[model samples]
Structures are given as structure tokens and as C-alpha cells.
Target: MEPVLLAAVVLFAGAYAFINGFHDVSNSVATSVRTRALTPTVAVVLASVFNLTGALLSTALALVLADRFIQLPAGTPGLGILIAGLLAACGWGLWTWWRRMPSSSTHALVGGIVGSGAASTLVGGPNIAESYQVLLQQIVLPLLLSPVIAFVLAYLLVFPTTWLMRYSSPRRGDAGNRIAQSVFTSAFSLGHGMQDGQRTMAVIVLALVAAGFSGTTGIPLWVQIFSGVALAAGSLFGGWRISRTLGSRLVRIDPLRGMSATAVSSSMLFLGAVWLQIPLSSTQTMTSAIVGAGANQRFSTVRFIPLREILVTWLVTAPVTALLGGILFLAISPLL
Candidate 1:
């Protein structure tokens, strides 16, 4: 890739990270805002700081995301292909965010890449369709299982936590738990930055390798530094709508419920990042945990309608983004 193309790839990847900072990262602090443990402004600021730190904290997850989910015969995708896929994901993200729906950025990105990879078949590139098997094991299976794990664990976990606090005065326990919730929210936000934010780091790495600026396994320091900053900057603005949806309309998130959900999501991310070394979707985990927390009270009280809408969005995001990415790549392939 030329310097111009490389620059464009960097910019697009950064922009995607920035959008993710607001769109996906909002899930981490939605409960904090709803429970009034942290005000909206405070939550955004705090999350931004922690997310930036987390983005820079490791390159392992970055490698996980940008590595060969769809390995090209050329080793990596071309500039045009990456741009098409990323832009497709970005468009889907912006659309969903504007509509105040909590969809998975992970799905959008994977879809975009898959779609673009398919398009490569038209240009005599290796069949990226062959990659679905690898991806099914690495990406798809985990995505299917994450929510199930989060829901069960969160539902079970909420009972013990609430029961243990049963004897403490409601007002007094609430006060102390808010602080605990804040700490958990902060940790969750950190994991959000590292796990979700690093998807963009992976994009940058793939771009670098394609551009001959870095190796597939090696992440440049500049990529880490810039992705963190871009994500933090994006988190600083326009997260309120997504925040509102996750915090309020999903289910009434009292401090305990909030803490329960936050803890579960944080644990999921931590395990994925450290032990499993996979790129899990915080949006999916958060929603599942939130549902678990709410359903623990009563099934009808959880508001199944909004969750259905979110589920629809999640179900379609991948195939839709993938389709969009394929079309965009095909349209632009001749130029590269």
C-alpha cells in the first residue's frame, strides 16, 4: 500500500475506534449512570480515562482481532478491501447508535471483514469463504456462548450478592455499594477499552502488516498510542443516547442490580482477554448480564419488547454489514 492508502487506513481505523469508544464502551457504564452511582458526565470522563489506559495496556488482544480470521493468499487484505469493510462497519455502528440500539460492534466488524473477504473472490484473491471454519471456532462459537454464560452466571450471582446484603440497612448498604459499583464500573470500563477498543488496534495492525510497516504478530507502539487516544476522544462525546438505552429502558438498574451486571460483564471480558485470548463482545455480554439481573426479579418486569428489538439488531448486524462490505469492496476493487 502506498503512504496515502496507509494514512487512509489509519484514519478509518481510528475513527472506528473513536465511534466504538462511545457506542460500545457505553455498555460498561450504563448501569453506573442509571443507578446514579456516577453522573453521566463523570461516567464518560472516567470511562474514557480507563479505556485509554486499557487500550494501551496490551497488544495481545490486538493481535487476536487483526490476525488471520480471513487470511488472504496475499497474506493480508489490500487497502481498498480494508477500507470498504471498515467503512461498512462504521456505517452500521453509526446507524445503530443513532437509533439508540445496543448492537455488537464485534458482529459488525466481523461481518464487514467477511463480506470484504468474499468480494476478494471476484478479483482472483484466495477464497476467504474458507476462513468461516476457522472463524466459527474462534469468533462465532464464542459469540454464541458468551451471552449464555453471562446470563446464567449473572442470574446466579445476583442471588447470593443480594441475599448477603439482606441484613444490612437498605440505605446504608446502598451508599457503600455505590462506591463498590463505581470501582466495578471503572474496571469494566478498563476491560471495555482493552477488549472492544483493541479491535481497532487489530485493524491498525492488519493495515500495518499489509502496508509492510509491521509484522503480523508485532504491534507498533504508535498504533497502540493512537488507538487509545482516538477511543478516549470519541468516548468524550455523543454517548448519551446509547447510555440512556442501556441504563434505563433495559431494566431498572438499582445499585445492586447494576453492580451484579457490571461484575458479570467485567468478568467475561477479563476471562476472554487474559485466559481465552479471544475478542468477545462487551455489548452482548452486558445486555445478557443486564437481563440476568432484571430477570432475577421477575421475567415480565424485564421488558422483553426492547430486548427483542436489540436482539433483532444483533442478529442482523453481521450479515448486513458483511453484505455492505462485500458490495463496497466490489465497487472499489478496480481502483486499488
Candidate 2:
């Protein structure tokens, strides 16, 4: 039974990765495509290749997630809860993608795990304090601050960039900006792969350890390849609806502005998160940077309605996934 459950968990985790790939590729490619820095096909293809290569950049993030996410009781975790959590997360991810909403797969996964794991505590899991710590230190802190960091850094850098490039004529400026944007896009995709892409491995390893299927919880080479490949494949497909939402609805992207945003976002991920081995939401990081870029030119250039909608989605993602995850736990508990 444990073996069966382990297999299922691994499959679910892979599915989640595939879903996450499509969900987030937009974050990296949207601006580039929007600004005409790269055609949509080229942008997506670039993201896929870069993401695939950087997928296993580090295992620290996987360790952090597997160890810190949910503290189950001693004996063994209820496989039902783990399975249900993954399913709920995947469901939420797909739903949001269909709705053209750019939601965080990490957010959905955390919410699903918390909701289901919290319910398992009723049967003999650890205290809620552990979950709280996971939320505060691991999830919430990174989620809230990373985006702000992305925004601030992007906002600050743009003015200087704008000033320095002011002397160049339109054609020269456009050429320079395109070259810079290409570099920035590649860098951001690498960072995105290192940070967000490793999470799929983390979740699967967590489930393996929790279920006692694997002796070790560390992310193995196989797990890295598996997760990375799945995510990259999803990115290749690309989320057109979400991409449109990110690329168009929020702000009209220009090459110079998009380059600034991508540069800031990549720096933040590589230094602020990846160096620290933390799982930052690429979705939020990229979107916030784009917002900051727009605001750098003029505050009014950004559309409030779509921005508001994405915020509302972010705000509700946790609790709603929590509810769904808990309900799923109940429904599946009997089988386990």
C-alpha cells in the first residue's frame, strides 16, 4: 500500500510540475514577447531550454521545502493527505490557468499541504505551531518580501537606466535595449529554473520520506531530471491565456522597460533567494518587477483592474486551497 501510494505521489508531483511549468513560463516570456524583444515562439523556446538546463541548479531549496513544509507526527504520514494535497494543488493550478490568472503553483502547493496536513493533525500530527513556522519563515516571508524586493530594485534601477540611455537615438536605443533584454531574459529564466523549478523535486521527496518509501529525503539526480524535464515541457507548451494577461492586461511593455524589470527580477532571484536556497514565487517576482517598470515611467500606465484581479487571486489562493485540501483529506482518509 505504501509503495502504491508512493508511486501515486510521485506521479502527482510530476503532474504538478508540468502544470507549474505552463503557469510560470508566462512570467519570464510575457514581457519579452510583449516588447517584441523576442517572438512568442522564440521566447517560449528560450525559456524552456534555459529552465530545463538550470532545473537542478541547487538542491538546497528542495531540502528547505522537504524539511520545513509540514511537520507530521512520528510514526508515518497519512498517504491520503499527501495525495489529496497534491491533487488539490494541481486542480487549483489548472483552474487558474484556465481562467487566465497567473497564480503561484508554490502558493497552491503550500496551501494544499497546509490544509490537508492541518486536518491530519486531528488524527495525530504535529502541533499547528510547526505549520505556522512554515508559513511565516518559509512561505509567507519569502512570498511577501521577494516581490517587494523585485519591485523596489527594478523601480530604482530604471530611472538610472533611462537617464544613461537618453543620449541614444531611437534605432540605437532599441537595438541596445533588445540585446540587453535578451541577456536579461536568459538570466531570469535560469534563476527561475534554479528557484521555482526545484520545488517539484522537493515536494516529491517530501512525500517519499513522509511515506517511508525512500530511506533518504534528499533530492536525487533522477528526481531533478524528472521534475526539470516535466516543467520545461510545460513551458514549451506555454500558457497563452495567462501570458496574454501578464503581457498585455497589466501594462504595455517596451523593450527598455521590460529589460529593467527582468534584470531586477533575475538579480533578486539569484542573490536574494537562490543564493539563500529559498523558494521564491517567480510569478510574483516577475509580475511585480513588470509593475515596478511601468510605475517607474508613470504610475498611471499600469492598469488597475487586471492587477486587482491577480491580487485577489493571490490573497485567496492559500485559504481556498486550504479548504479544498482539507475536504480532499476527509474524502481520501478512509482509503488510506
Candidate 3:
């Protein structure tokens, strides 16, 4: 790749990292804000700070997984593919924003890369089956499972705790629940750093590798630091629109329920970060945990209406972005 073009690709990837941070900010703070445990500004600031810390401290598991999924063949025309992928992701993001639907930027990026890979195959580029399998196992399976797991777990955990606390004074119960919420919220922030922040780090590493600037052995410290800063800055800005939907629209969350949900979600995210090294969607995991906690109280606690919209976005994200990526790649290839 030409030096100038590679620089442009790296810059574009950084922009994507920032957008990913902004797009997913709600995942980290929505429950805390909605429950009034933390103000929106305070919640975001804390989450942002923790996000940067997590990125800096955690291992680069997601980066390796992503590289496996989207590695272009040696001598593959990378500039066109990179540009198309970024453009396609941006297009999907804009569409989601316009519709006021919260979608996964990670999914959008995957879609773009897959689309470009398919386009490359049409012109006799390297096979990408390994990448596809990684996507299926890591991304798709987790998306399907996280919410169901969260809903079940939350439902089971919340009701029992509620029942146990029923005889207590409301004031006493609130105080205890608030304390628990604080702990769970902190844990969730750490997990958010481990899981969500790592996704951007992975992308940055991928861009560097593509540009012949890094390797699979490990990510450079500067890359880790820069990616962390970008993501944190984006989180600090926050996304109020999606936060409302997640924090309030999903269900009425008291401190106890909030703690239960956050704890379960954080557990899942941390496991993914530490063990699987797969890039699971924090939004999906947390939402599922929230649903599970709500379901523990009653099936009615799980709001099906907003969930229906989210499901639609989830289903459409991969295919639509993939198609867009393919189109963009084809259009830009000749110019390159």
C-alpha cells in the first residue's frame, strides 16, 4: 500500500473508533442514569474514565479474533477494501441514527468487512472462511445468546432478592440496594472497559497490521493508549437518545434490580474479555441481563415492544451493512 493511502486508512479507522465509542456509550451508563444512581453527566464521565483504564490494562483478545475474521489475502487490494468498509459502516450508522434506533457499530464494521471480503473473492482474492467462522462463533452466537441469558438470569435473581427484602422497611431496603448498586455499577464499568473498549483497540490493531505497522504478537502501547483515549472521549460526550431507551424504556429499575442486572452483565462481559477473547456486544449482554432481572420479577417486566425494534436492527445490521460495503468496494476499486 502507498504510504499516503495507508495513512488515510489508519485515520479513517481512528474515526471509526471514536464513532464506536459514541455509539455504544449508552451500554455502559444507561441503567445507572435511569435509576438515578448517577446523573447522566456523572455516569458518562465515570464510564469514560474507566473505559480508558480498561482498554489500557486488558489483554488484546478481541484484536486477535477480529484479525482472524477479516484478514485480507497477501497482495489483496487493501486500500479500496478499507475505504469501502469504513464508508459502509458510516452509512449504516447514519441510517440507525436517523431512525432513532440503537444499533451495534461492531456489527456494522463486521458487515462492511464481510462484504468487502466477498467482493474480493469475486475477483479471485484470498478465501475468508476462517474469518466467517470466527464471526459466527464469536459475534453471532453471543448476540443470540446474551439477551436470553441476561433475561433468564435477571428474572431469577431479582425476584428472590426482592422476596427476601420484602419485610424490611422501604428506607432500609433502598439504602442497602443503593450500596449494592454502587458495587455492581463499578463492576459493570470495569467489564465495559474490558469488552467494549477492546473492540476499538482490535480495530486499530487491524488497521495498523493492514498498513504494515503492527503484528499479531501484540499491539503497541501507543496504539492501546490512543485507542483508549479516543473511545473515552467519545463516551464522555455520551448518547442521550439511546440512553433513555435502554435505561427507562426497557423496564422500571429499582436499585436492587439495577444491581442484579449490572452484575450479571458485567460477569458475562468480563468472562468474554478474560477467557474467550471474543468481542461480545456489551449492549446485548447488559440488555439481556436487565431483561433477565426484570423477568425474575415477572414476565411482564420484560418489555417486548422496544425489544422488538432492537431485534429488527440486530437482524438487519449485518446483511444491510455487508451489501453496502460490497457496493462501496466495487465503486471505489476502479478509482484505486
Candidate 4:
């Protein structure tokens, strides 16, 4: 019974990673595809390859998630919390993806954990305060600030990029811009793997800990490969609906601005994952960068209705997932 339940937890974690890829990886390539820098197929392939590379390269952020997030109890009850949290995150990812909305998988996962942690208290689980503290200090604060910074940095970056290209012929500039977009989108996908890959890895590690197979948060190589492959597979599948929203509905993006957005977002993702050991939303950073770069051309070019809808969803994602996680945990605890 215990082994079967552990397998179920692993299965759900894989599902979250796949849903994450379907929903979030598209952000890395949306601008590149829209700008004709890469065809849809090429972009998705590049993203999948680099995302796997990035996932395999590091476990720094994954360590933070395992050690600092929440304390998972030993046995089936702990597995139940993880199952509920994963389901909540997966459900939110699918819902937002279906709506063609680009939402944060990172936040959804954190909210799910926080929600499940709170619910676990009823079953003599660890205090929820620790999870709450980390959520605010680590996840929520960064979530609020990173998007604004991505927007401003991208907005400023467009000035210099445009200025540098001003002297070049349109044909020459377009060619250079395409190359730049491709390179930056690859880098962004690599960074996305680093940021989001750790998320699923952390959840898997937590599951292992709960099952009493491991005494520490050390990530096994097999676990890393499994998480990487799941995410990469999802990336291969891609999310064209949300990609269309990001590529066309939010702003009219040109090759130069698209390159600038990718550059800014990729740099931010690297900074957050490698240096800060923090998780960031590739979707949030990329979307904000697109808007930022587009606003530089003309604010009117930024569509408010769609942007408003995205913002509302972003604002509600954590809270709504938290509630959903709690409900799911409560509902499933008895069976587990």
C-alpha cells in the first residue's frame, strides 16, 4: 500500500512537470516564433533540448526547495499532502493553459505546497508557519518584484538596442535581429530549465523523503534525469494557444524587441536561479519583457484587455491554488 501510494505521488509530480512544460515553456519561444526568428517546430525543439540541458546542469535551487520549504511527515499522510498539492498545481496549470493564459507554474506549486502544509496540521503534520514564511520571503516577494523589474529592464534595453541598430540597413538589421532572437531564446529556455526544473525535482525529493528512502535532500542523478525528461517532453509538445496569446495578443513584437525581451528574461532567470538560488516564473518574466519592450514602441500597442486578464489571473493564482490545495488535501486524506 505504501509503495503504491509513493508511486502515485511520483506520478503526480511528473504530471505537474508536464503541465508546467505545456503551460510555461511556451513563453520562452513565443516571441521568437512570432518574430519569425524560428519556426514553431524549430523553436519548440530548441527549447526542449536546452531545457533538458539546463535541468541536468544544476540542483542548487532544488536544494533550497527540499531543505527550506516545508517539513513533510513520514508515511502516507505526507504523501497525501504532496498528492493534493500536485493535483492543485496541475489543475491550475491546465485551466490557465486552456484559457490561453500564461500563468506562473512556480507560484502555483508554491501555493499548492503552502496550502497542503496548512492542511497537514490537522493530521499532526509540522507547523504551517515555516511554509508560510518561505512562501512570502522567497516566492511571493520575488513574484511581485521580478515582473516589474523585467518590464523596466526590457523597456530600457530596447532603447540601446534600437539605437545600436539605427545605423544599419533594414535588411541587415532584420537578419541580425533574427539571429539574436534565436540565441537569446535558447538561453532563456536553458534558464527556464534551471528555474522550473528544480521545482518538480524538489517535489520528487520531498516525496522520497516522505517515503523514508532518503534521509537528506540530496538529489539523485536518476531523479534529475526523470524530472528533466518529463519537462523536456512537455516542451516538445508545446502550448500553441498560450504562445499565440504571448506572441500576438499582448503586443505587436518585432524582431529587435523580441530579441531584447528574450535577452532580459534569460538574464533574469539565470540571476534568480544561479546566483540567488531562487525560483522565478519564466512566463511572468517573458511576458513582462514583451510588454516592456512593446511599450517602448507605443503604449497603445499594448492591449489592455488581455493584459488586464493576465494580471488578474496572476494576482489570484497563489490564493486560488492555496484554497484548492487545501480542499484537495482534505478531500483525499482519508483515502490515503
Taken over the whole model, the C-alpha lDDT of each candidate is: 0.82, 0.81, 0.73, 0.88
Q: On residues 1-336, what C-alpha lDDT tens digit does candidate 2 reach at each position?
A: 777777888898889888888888888888888878898889889999888877867777777777776665432355666777888889999999999998878888888877888777665645344567767786778887887888788788888988988899978897788888888898888887877677888777766776765533467889999989998998898778888887889887788888998998888778744567677888888899998887877645889999999999998998889889988877776666
What would the per-residue lDDT of candidate 1 be over residues 1-336, giving only the tens digit for each residue?
357777888899888888888787678778887888998788888888988988888878778667756564343347667888889989999999999998888888889988888898878766667778978888888998999999899889878988899899999878877888899889887888888777888887777777777777777888889989988888777467787778878787778888888989998898898788887888999999988887788544687788899989989999999999999988877666
Scored by Cα lDDT, where does model 1 land?
A: 0.82
The better candidate by lDDT, 3 or 4, is 4
Compared with the true structure, the alpha-carbon lDDT of candidate 4 equals 0.88
Better of 1 and 2 by lDDT: 1
Candidate 4, poorest ten consecutive residues by summed lDDT: 123-132
Mind giving the per-residue lDDT tens digits that candidate 4 earns over 78-126? 7888888899999999999999999998888878877887887776655
Misplaced by over 4 Å in model 4 are 122-126
- How close to the true structure is residue 313 of candidate 4, measured as C-alpha lDDT? 94
Write down the TM-score for model 3.
0.91
Ranking by lDDT: 4, 1, 2, 3
**Top model number, lDDT:** 4
Show the colliding residue pairs in model 1: none
Identify the superior model by TM-score, candidate 1 or candidate 3. 1
In candidate 1, stretches whose alpha carbon ends up further than 4 angstroms from where it belongs are 73-77, 298-300
Off by over 4 Å in 2: 73-76, 123-129, 215-217
lDDT of 3 by residue, 148-229 (tens): 7777887778767888899999888877887777667767777777776666666656666666666767777777777678
Candidate 2: residue 307 lDDT (0-100): 94
TM-score of each: 0.95, 0.94, 0.91, 0.97
